[model samples]
Target: MRTAGLALAGFLAAAPAWAEFTTGDALVIGNARYGETVTAFGPDAVQAVARALRLRGQEVEQLANGGAVAMQQALDGFVAAIDEGETPLIVVLSGQFASVDGGPVLRPAGRETSKAAGLSLAAVLEVLAQSPRRAFLVLGEAGEATALEALEIPEGVTVIRGPAAKVAEFAAREMAQPALPLEKSADWYGLALSGHASDGLAVLTHTEVRPPSEAEQAAARDRIALLDETAWQRAVESGAFQAYLDSYPQGLHAEAALQMRDGAPAISPAKAEASLALDATARREIQRSLTQLGHRTGGIDGIFGPGTRGAITAWQRQSGTDPTGYLDAAQVARLAKEAAQSPAPSAPRPRRASNAVSAQEAATWNMARGERGLRAYLGQYPNGAFAARARVKLSNMQRGSGQ
Candidate 1:
């Protein structure tokens, strides 16, 4: 059994009132058998880390002798779970770490010696970058300083990498206690590890976290207000939400921004009203056209309210129009023509063969079904050709529901 130090109790007592402990999830991977060579203590160290995490009230997933396929699946599932909320994440990796093409890659248990077979550290960072919460990554059997130096960890994430034995020793000692505040634990771990030689341990983070100054907090608030305004202005534009997420992945409006970016249409009521230059007949014509194009307009009332605007935006997006949810003379004519050509409601559309379905086509197909289908399509082809449009549709749907 792994001995947990008094770190947990100390953390609870010493941490600031705002820094209370919260439940989190941990992934502990240990591979003792990698082709021919085996780390004597790798498996033991992983168990120790898992025990420590569990003692601190974290949900733990432990994998022993995990191969490439298993590791990939585990990481994908973990990332997806974290993306659903602001859950804290802890990752403990023990095994061979190889440096390839001036970067670091973790080697899972397998006979593959080819560098291409290994998992790149950059790839791991990319998934973690999508997380909107704090993360701690502890690496064992990764003593290569050059590899650690070359890593570009994202902000809000911390990394500790070192020799298997020494890294495991430090983790065991720290976790043996009740619990220590994460920041304090990192500080303590850094100090303890630094006492060893460079070859023994290494620590790196994108930025050193500290309590924000009053001015900094005020600046952040101002930036958030600006972001909110921008989101309102470009709520229908996927690029706008993308830009917001790029700047503040975990911002206050992050969930809202994600909904917009994924395909939720957020038309400004004022903008919609001002842009409505068409007479009632034209508006009804557009609504009927949208209905023919398989979009719902909530009874075609000839008003450019949320329902009509949402339907127009969906149709416009599908038909490769500007998706402004406002129709000009030319666009109205084109829509009328397309509506005339479309099959009646009872007619069956041709279905593409499964193997022949392109990612974009799949996205469009799924989007027509509903939000669940759109989400499934995104899961299948997150970076597919029509992913942007699919996201837009989903965002619009969520926005329609007032999310």
Candidate 2:
């Protein structure tokens, strides 16, 4: 079967041309001269897009058919333009991209020599990392790569990579029309995009920031006041103003609630989660619930990091909540309940007899692993020596989790 094209995860956004409204900087390097053996990449296409950017008044630093030294000089110019202003920075390199011993490098024109002959993409990526908001790196693969290696792209920066000619074409077309988003355009070309570049990224964007009109400000105040009043009424009915204040710091009756609690510090969302005093075991249970519910919390490890935060955000987005990427006491409870209603991620692994771990040790380990993993072991070895260890482990777990 024939395939369309291979895509790594993530997306990229090209900036709008801005000789007038915005100032956008671009670094475009096209290296087509590899050797007689390699296929020539799109030198003409990248230059076309560079010309398009320049036409829109963007500071364009382009190196056409450049060698390693020339490519390095182009990178310096790109950075200098960025330091001059805070604007959208677009970098495009179309040529023989390959995975070398050190890292991902673009083989410059007139280079069939050592790995050092190629320009390091890692350095360019580092520069892009700084201006992440408007930073994007469009890598167009010129020739067929013998080995496809994953490039380590940082957060906030977008990346769109595919066959050199097609991507360069896409970039040229999209840059010409700033209104066309990348997601919609890439879909037609079978390209994949990631990061903030998703949901159709466009070139030459000027985000006009103006204060909300009188009507808009009034509407917002009305909404917040209504929420505050409702919370206040509920607090009065339940005589739990302290709890109400903990949940809403800016409620209408917040000052009254504060007086009721003798001016206790309001519990922030972060503080509330910390108040759970969750141990590793409790954390794993939370992760399990999230994973089981198909949020994919990376792994069932206890610590909550970016993966867990992302999972939480995903869950919130699905549920139409605030999507704050943080969990409070109530949100945790809701997640637990929802996960119970949902099916498991996968079936339990069947026990296998192996010399590496004895049955008793396995039973104890299973006890350590959550989700009633101890049933098989307990049903068989009710009074084994390992059973005693498992019981002690459970007690430690309960204490650690503050349960």
- Candidate number achieving the greatest lDDT relative to the actual structure: 2
Q: How badly does each model clash, as a count of residue pairs?
A: 24, 9
| Overall lDDT per candidate, in order of appearance | 0.54, 0.60
| Local error of candidate 1 at residue 338 (angstroms) | 55
What local lDDT score does residue 40 receive in model 2, on the 0 to 100 scale? 34
**Candidate 1: which stretches are off by over 4 Å?**
1-21, 131-133, 142-145, 173-403
RMSD of 2: 24.6
List CA RMSD, all candidates.
Answer: 20.5, 24.6
lDDT of 1 by residue, 1-403 (tens): 0111111223457752222333455677766565546663355666677666555545455555554545665565355334234345667777777778847877766454666566567777665555433456667774344555566777755666666665677666653344244445545655222111222122221111223234334433432343333333333332344544433445444665676556556644333432444555776788778777877764454444455667778887988977776666667788899999998654232222122346666545534456787677777666443344356446445534546
State candidate 1's TM-score.
0.40
Best-fitting candidate, scored by TM-score:
2
* Residue-level lDDT tens digits of model 2 in 158-249: 87777876777777776446657767777777766765674556755643212323433443343334334344444554555554553345
Can you give the lDDT of residue 118 in candidate 1? 62
Show model 2 residue runs off by greater than 4 Å: 1-20, 37-43, 146-148, 206-403
